[model samples]
Target: MKIIPAQEFEMKRESDYGTPEQNAAVKEIIQAVRREGDAALLRYTEQHDKIKLIAGSLRVQESELQAAYDQVEPSFVNAIRAAAERIRSYHQRQKRNSWMDLQPDGSILGQIIRPLQRVGVYVPGGKAAYPSSVLMNVIPAQVAGVPEIVMVTPPATGGTEGINPYILVAAAEAGVTEMYRVGGAQAIAALAYGTDSIAPVDKICGPGNIYVALAKREVYGAVNIDSIAGPSEIVVLADDTAEPSYVAADLLSQAEHDEMASAVLVTPSRQLAEAVAVEVERQLELLPRRDIARASIDSYGAAVVTASLDEAISIVNRLAPEHLEIMTQDPMEIMGSIENAGAIFLGPYSSEPVGDYFAGPNHIIPTNGTARFSSPVDLDDFIKKSSMIYYSKEALLRDGETIMELARREGFEGHARAIAIRLEQEQASQTGGNDHEL
Candidate 1:
């Protein structure tokens, strides 16, 4: 890790729009699926995932879902079940009810909050299994009262004949109503456009490779997508009182995620900054994903030294990291000044992984510098709000002229006429006079 002054350190935000070839490939795949439906989906799966399947076999069987239990340990099942309950409970608090406000004029105005009828979650599969990802994406939709939650993963994961057992169990525990064995951009198209085997979804959520991200970007208008997620990031804002070892470990947690992932430390104490730089190098050698971590640390990791704790926080806001850990004498007090961060961890024990796996908060957070403008995945991501207005005759009549003035000012004669016609009829019914003249 390079130790540099705050003025010299610059946080890089890498865009994952993908190469032109990759974009063209994704576009071709999406168009093929749109034109050929299930045939294109099956062909792409065989070509990219090295698995062949018929339309009848696209959807995972109910027996396969139940039998997945026998393939995993009881301990694993218990943990996932516990995690699901916590995730569901946390999101349930965010659930909103449709509301209306009545006025003295007999007018009603409010918002109608309703969950999406159907949602598709794309879970990445192949050499790795992320039961945690399944739980993170599915439970929020379920909490928002989404009736049908569909999950799609590659047919074979970890060299197994079918999807990873852990992922299957997680999906089952999260109350997914449907599961499919399709993957890649093809799966995204099937979810967006629908096929003979998979019904279309109103929205799609989850993480995948460059192809998946591009596919989500391509099909956004047809269906809602969560976000084009970038690499993981963690920024530790520590003081002299912070433990170097703990700081180093927290930084490495994100570094091991991807070669492009960034792990940064912003602090005022020069001694602590040097200590953490050494500790990160020491711990990097021990990680199973050390090669990936090393590349990340070498390329993007940094220790920014500042003149004071306040300056350290200023740097953090500019970075707007995905995850932030405050390990100072007063972490809570410092958090009050933080304007940008997807998730904030206070004190030493509240590690990043605690929120990533067990702690109730969703781990699907805004990455890069996007935390400055966006938010983590929540119940709002699964539900939509429709504005409701019930204008009584009195209410419309009282404001009709004002409405017409504004509409006509905008050069919308049709809009003005729509309000004018109603106003004329209502005023004539009340008084035997033309409302337009009045």
Candidate 2:
């Protein structure tokens, strides 16, 4: 690790969009699924995942879901159930209702909030199985009252029953009614376009590799997507009062996610900066994924020294990190000044992984400075809102001219006429004659 001034520290973030070759491959895969349906889905699954499957056995049967529980340890099942409950309890507060505001003019102007009819959650099972992802993505949709929540993941191996037992157990605990043994760009296409076995979904959520990201981008307009999530990111903003060991461990937590992940520390105290840099080296040796973490620390990690605490905040806002940890004398006092961060950890005890696994909040946050504009996945991601407008006869007649004036100013003659025709009919009925005669 190296210590540099705040002015010299820059985040090395790669584009979420994959290479040209990858993009072309994704486009070809999506089109094949659209044209051939189940045939293309199975062929691609066999080619990419090395899993031969018949169309009849594509969906995960209920007996298999029940058998998954026998494979997973009792302790693992207990923890997943507890986490699911917390996640469900937390998101329950975010649930919204359909409401209408009755007006004095006898008009109802409000919004109708309804959950999407069907949603697809893509869980990555390439390098590892993310049972936590099943909880994070499925629980919120359940709280939002989504009726049909479908989940898809690649088989852990070549066999039809090669899906990871832990992931299966997690999805079952999270209340997923439908699941499929498929993965990669083919799975994304199946969710978006629909196959003979898999029904099309209204929206897709969760994280995946470069191919999966590109596939989601290609099929975006056909179905709604959560985001083109980037690699993991973490920034620890601390002062002299913060613990160096705690800071280094939290930074490494994110760095271990992948070689492209970024972990940075911004502080005003030079002594703390130097201490953390040394602590990071000592801790990296102990991590199981030290090779990945070392590459991440060597390529993208930094310890930025600033002139003042206020200046450190300015640097953080510019970066707009995905996970920000504030370890200071008074963390709460500093939190109000933070303008941009996907998730904020207030003290040393509140580590980034706390939110990633056990904490109630969703771990699916925006990345690569997208926190400046977006937010973490929540109940709103699973629901769609429709605006309700019931214009009263009195209100429409009163505001019809104003509406027409604005519409015509924008060169919309048809829009103006729509309002004009309604107004003319109402006026003629009221006066018992046409407007010209009146």
Question: TM-score for every candidate vs. truth?
Answer: 0.97, 0.96
Total backbone collisions for each predicted model: 0, 0
Model 2 deviation from native, Cα RMSD in Å: 1.8
Question: Which 10 consecutive residues of model 2 have the lowest summed lDDT?
Answer: 154-163
lDDT of each: 0.92, 0.91
Question: Alpha carbon lDDT of residue 364, candidate 1?
Answer: 96
Q: Can you write out model 2's per-residue Cα lDDT over 316-435, one digit (the tens) per residue? A: 999999999999999999999999999999998999988988889999999999999999999999999999999999899889999999999999988998999888888788889766
What's the CA RMSD for each of the models? Answer: 1.6, 1.8
lDDT of 1 at 18: 94
* Model 2 local distance difference test score: 0.91
